[model samples]
Every structure is written in structure tokens, then in C-alpha cells.
Target chain A: MTKKKIEKQLSLPFRNAFQMSLRSLKIRFGRSIIVTMSILLGIAFLMSVFSSNAFTNALIEKGPEALRATMQQNSQELRTRSIWLVSLSLLVCVVGIVNAMLMSVTERSREIGTMKCLGALDRFVMELFLLESLAHGLLGSIAGAIIGIFAITIVFLLQHGRLAISVFPAGALLKYSLVSIILGTTLAVIGALYPAYVSARMEPAEAMRREV
Target chain B: MPKEAIVRTIGLKKTYMLGKIPLPVLKGIDLEILKGEYISIMGPSGSGKTTLFNMIGGLDKPTEGKVYIDEVDVAQLDAYELAWLRCRKIGYIFQTFNLIPVMTALENIMLPMIFAGLSTDEAMEKARQLLVTVGLGERIHHKPFELSGGQQQRVAIARALANDPAIILADEPTGNLDLRTGKEIIQLLKQMNREKKVSVITATHDLKMLDVSDRVVWVRDGLIERVEDRANLDIKIGEVEGEEAG
Candidate 1:
């Protein structure tokens, strides 16, 4: 093949993958929305835990002179508990994503077979499923971050008459939101990989034989 | 070696493992398809016509023997090569109109061209032309659910023609349609075969296909029981008598 031909072949999979992902979202609109909401709630729980005034204040309440001593005494205990809570919430979120993706793959066996019959590469199939999960992850995480910020603001306003922005550090919340987005995306990809792999490696004949 | 035989199979066999028992689906078959010939494979359910079709299409690997398409041994080609062959060399139409329901008819038709490395504009141009050829130009924007069973099959035929493949393998292309619609689809397929000179291999129980086929293959119990040329169709009567006698 000429260079132009090679380039076209290389790029074709990405284009098809993109189209396949869009089609998947359209076909499974309801299920996708539910998965996104689940991720949003999980990330929301994470944000609430970190942004809640009670938690932040508990760490910052001690005076500077005693801060070093308090940090030495209680920092390890607080960090461990926070880690556990965050881990548990993210775990729940990942489970939901995996369940949704597994169902999606199972339901689309015929579609997958049809794609394979049309000469879709395994990489194309992988890219399709991965992109779908990534889209859901990003959307859900952004929504969760915004919801978390508003939620923290509401709690602070109720606790104090003013906005009380100082109660939650802007810098810290921004960092946490960014982290949540990355974590959510990573979790979504991980959860979707196995099912996508299975779908991609399926024999076209066997996949076609399966009832949708 | 016949210069015109585009597809050839030798001792092709496929066995499925039902638990520990080796249940053979295709038992040692030899067949050849000449270029641009319309061949209909007629068989009862579970007779392995689909298995043989799958082998020829490179959709499944045979347990034993070789399937050669245009002189390339299918078993010798790696997965990537096989996929490319499927994309550029063969087209498939299914009984269920196995279209991606989320896609519009045009998108479905564009899929194989896209796989064959055609740019979006090129694929779209050819897809539109194929839709027109299949008489589905008005339904290009419709999803599968929006189209009737006959219309969906038309879209599928358009899709099967997307890449302008050398061979079209249709597995019961009219199995789901009403008789009138089925006849129309068969006529459309015949028109394409004659005009485009693309070989068509249809595995079906529909006798209407015999009218358009250049030859007919009868399969029974995982074996090709007989092959009859259109000009010599009296052979079917002889085979029936032979079976009755045996």
C-alpha cells in the first residue's frame, strides 16, 4: 500500500470508533443516563466528605502553636478514615459503571456481530466501548463537582448567615474536583475494559448466533 | 485451476463440541464458486449451509481444510488480513436485517466503505448511490425500526453493496418478508448481480430464488448432496429418484 493508503487505513478505525460510540449512546440512552447519575452521586459523596465544614474545621480548629502537636497526634487517624470513606464510595461507583457496561455489551451482541461482519477491527470495538465510558465519566464527574460545590455552599450558608467561602478552601475544592474527574474517568475505563475486550474478541459467527 | 473460480473450498469441516461429544456440522465438503455466478444453496435447517457460508465469508474458522478466496487461503491469513478481506472482498446480507438500529440507513450503508478505508465523503457518495440502486433513496434517513421489514432488507442490500465487494453472501435474505416483498427483494438482488456483475451466493429455503440462480446446491446432513446447473435442472429429479431408491 502507498503512504496515503496506509494513512487512510490507520485513521479509519478512529472514525468508525467515534461513530460507534455515538450510536451506542443513542441506542442505550436511558441506561447511559442512569450510569452517569450513579457516577455523579458517588463523586458527590466524595466531595461532600471532603468539603463539609465539620470535617475541614475539625482539622483546622486548633491554634498554630498547638497545630504541629495536634497534626502529629491526629493526622494519621484522620487520613486513614478519609481514605476508607472515599475508597468505599468510589468502589460503589465503579460497581455501578461495570454493571451498566456489562449489560450494554450483553445487549449489543448482535450489533457487535454486525460490526464485525462489516470488517470492524478489534481495536475499533475497544475504542467504541472505551469512548462511551469516558464520555459518561466526564459528564458525570463535572455534574458531581458542580453539585458538590453548591451543596457545600448550602451547608455553610445554613451554618453561618454569610457565604462562608472561607470555611471551604477554594484551592482545595478545585484540586478535589479535578482529582474526582480523573478518578471517575479512570474507574469508568477500567470497569469497561473487560467487557469490551470480551465483545471485541467474540467470533462474528458466534456473536451473530446469539439472540439479542 | 479454473481461472473464473473466485472462491474454492477443500475438505472443509466444522465440528462443535456439545459437551464432550464432537458434533460435526460440516463434514468434508468441496465447492467452487465462479466469478459473477448466482448460486443458491438450498438446505433444511441444521444442514450446515450456514456453516459453509460462514467459512467462505471468513466469519468462522473451519475445524479442518481450507477456504480459498481469490487464491488466498483463508486459514493462512492472520486476523488482520482476514478482516481486510471481509471488508473489501465480501458483502453479507442477513435474514434478520441485522442493521445497527441506532444508525440511519445511509450510515449503515456507509459502514463497510468506511471499513475499507474510504474517506467519509467518498463513502457517503457511494453509500447514497447504493441506496438509490437498492431503491431505498427515500428512506436513507430512517432508522431500522422506522422502516418496514422489506425496506430494512433493502437498506441491508445497500449496505452489502457499500464496498462494491466481489461477492455477496446472503443468508436467507427474504426469510422475514411477506411473499410479495420477498419476490421484490429477490428481483432487486438479481438486478444487481446482472448489472454490477457481482457474484451472489444465497443460502435459502425459498424456491423463488431458483428462478434467478445460475446454479443450485442442495445440502443435506452436513454434506452437499447435489449441485445442479440451471440448464440441466432435470438432475434434481434424478437425484430425488436416486434418494427414493436408496
Candidate 2:
């Protein structure tokens, strides 16, 4: 075949990979939802903590002269404790996403074999898993950010009544949500890498035999 | 010169490592298949017929020797090149009807074409045509779980034809079906081999294969015991099956 023809043929495999990812998510919708929930909760946790920290920092920056020093001391302590706790929760969530993706890869060995036999390249196989996880990450992160905003708002309302609204800066919450989205996507990609590699390197014959 | 054989294997050999023991699968298989010929590799279990199919289809590498498809040495091709060749030149069907369960019959049929780089519209058109050819047009929207064994196999056949491959390799294509369904599947394969001029190489122990194959290659213990043309098939296939059963 001509070079142009080869390029033309290369065009559809990515589209097919994307479609395969969608089909997989739909077929395993329950598992997908669970994975999404893990990511959402993890990101939401981080966002809420960060938003609260931002609120404390803002208080120290603009609080009454008499209260600023004590508030600064309190903010330092809260930041240190929350950072360690948030980091631990995030680690657990990453591990959970990795475990979920690994299971998904194992369950689809035969489907992977069939795709490989049909001429899917290793990269295409990798792309399918990565895209699936990425979709979950984007969806979960967005949802988590929305929920985190409400969570931060609720915590502040309960703690400080109507004055809590003034202390919870809109700009700070947006920043926290943005940071959580990025972290969620990064964690998801990291978790998916090993599973994608496992799926891509599977021998088609062996994979099919496993299913049979 | 005459046209080169569509598939040729020279001294093809494969061995597996089972702990410290070595198990030979294909012991120096040398074979050639011509275009449009319907050939069957007949053997009992452990005869390495499936291994031979995998070699020719580029699904596995041989420990020794070479596989040449359309006169191109398969070993010399990189992974990308092998993938490209598999996509555009060969199709495979399995006994278990390895259709993606999550996909509808139409989507399964369109898969190979998608890998071959056809646009969605073009792939869908070809897939629709192939489904009709395999008599699964009415069931195109059904998932594999919803289809009968025969219908699922038909979907697999349609998927195999999606790329319009020069050769189709079927590994125990009817092994999972009933007698009547097996016979029907064989007939469909034969029809495609004849009308489309697509070479077909099937590994099967089914006695009915003796009726449809242009040539039969009997493999024993990872070696080709004999190759016989249909016109010169002196042994009674049914008697052979009965003897094996006994």
C-alpha cells in the first residue's frame, strides 16, 4: 500500500480505541461508578481540606489586629496536620484506582485478545485503558469539586453562622477545585499505567487461552 | 512465473518451556497454501494445528524457521509492520466465537475494518454488507450473549471478512457448535473461499471438513503426516473418525 494509504489506515485505530473504552465502561458501568466514587471522594476530601486551610490563611491575612497572631499560630498547626492526613487519604485512593483498573484488565483478557487478533496495536490497547481511566478521572474530579464547594460552604456555615460566607472566599474555593481536578487526573493516570502496560503486553494466544 | 503462494512456512518450529522441560509444538512444519484454496489441517488434540495457524497469522513467533505471507518474511517485520499486515491481509476466527460480548454484532463486524483505518461510515457499510452475507443482518444489533451458538459463529465469520483479508485462518471454527450448525458454518466458509477467492486455512477434527476442503493436511504429533487432495482422498473419513472414537 502507498504511504498515504497507510496513514489513512492508521487514522481509525485511535477512534476505535476510544470507542472500545466507551463500550467497556458501559458494560462495566457498576464497576466504573465505584471507581468514580473512589476518585470523587478522594478529590473531594482534598478540596475541602484545602479550602478550609485557605479560609484560615485568609483570616490570618486580614483578621482584627488583636486576633491575628493567635490565628496565625492556629493556622500553622491546622495546615501541618491536615496536609499529613490529606496525603494519606490520597494515597489510599490512588491504590484503590490501581486495584480497580487491574481487575478490569484481568476481566477483559479475552476481549483484549480478540482486539489484538483484529489488528489492534499495543499502543491502541494501552490507549483504551488510559482513556477509560481518564474519562473516570475527569468525571469524578468535576463532581468532587462541585461537592467539595458545598462541603466547604456547609462547614463554614455550621462553624461561624452568617459571617462564614464572608470568610469563605470564592477565589480561594475556585483555586482549590482547580488543584483537586489536576491532582485527581494525575492520580488516575498514574494508577492506570501499570494496568495498561499489562494489557498491552499480553500475548494474544495466551490471553485467548485464558478466557477459553 | 506463477503467482507466489499466499502463505508459505519453511521449517517452522515452536517449543514451550514448562519449568525445566521443553515441549515441542510445531516440529519443523513446511507448508504452502495457494490463493482461493480451502484447506483443512486435520488432527487430534495436541497435533499443533492451532500453532501452525498462529504462526501464519502472526499471532505467535516460531522458535525456528520462517513464515512468509505474500512472499514477505514475517520474522523480518517489526511489531508495527506485523500488526499492519495482520490488519490488512489476514483474518481469524476462533472455535469459541471470540466476539467482544459488550459489542453488538454490527460493532464486532466493524472492528477489523476500524483497525485497518477505514472511516466509520466506510467500515459500517462494509460491516453491514458482510453481516448480510453471513445471514446475520437481522441480528446485527444483538450482543453475543443474545445470539445462538450458530448465530454467534456467523457474527464471527462476518467479523473475519471485515478487512477483506487475503487469507482467513480459522482455529476449530465449529468446535463449539452442534453438528448441523458446524456443517452450516463450514458451508459458509467454503462459499466465501470460492466466491471471494480468499484462501482459507482451518484447523479442525470435524469429519465434515473432508467434504468441503479442496485439500486436507493431516498433522500428527506436531508434524505433517500427509497432505492429500480431495480428488485423491482414498480413505473413508467417517471410518477414520469411527476408528479414532473406538
The most accurate candidate by lDDT is 2
Question: Candidate 1 chain A, which ten residues in sequence have the lowest lDDT sum?
Answer: A1-10
Query: Which ten contiguous residues of candidate 1 chain B have the minimum total lDDT?
Result: B236-245
Q: What tens-digit string does per-residue lDDT give for candidate 1 at B17-101?
A: 9999999999998999999999999999899988888998989889999888877788777667767777878999999999988
* Candidate 2 Cα outliers beyond 4 Å, as residue runs: A1-8, A13-20, A59-76, A210-212, B1-4, B232-234, B241-246
Candidates, DockQ: 0.40, 0.43
Fnat, model by model in order, equals 0.55, 0.57
What TM-score do all the candidates reach, one by one? 0.87, 0.89
How would you encode candidate 2's per-residue C-alpha lDDT over A72-179 as one tens digit per residue?
767768778988977876776667656665666677777778788888888877787789889988888889888877887788788667666666677887887888
Scored by lDDT, model 1 comes in at 0.81
Per-model tally of clashing residue pairs: 0, 1
Docking class of 1: acceptable
lDDT of 1 at A202: 74
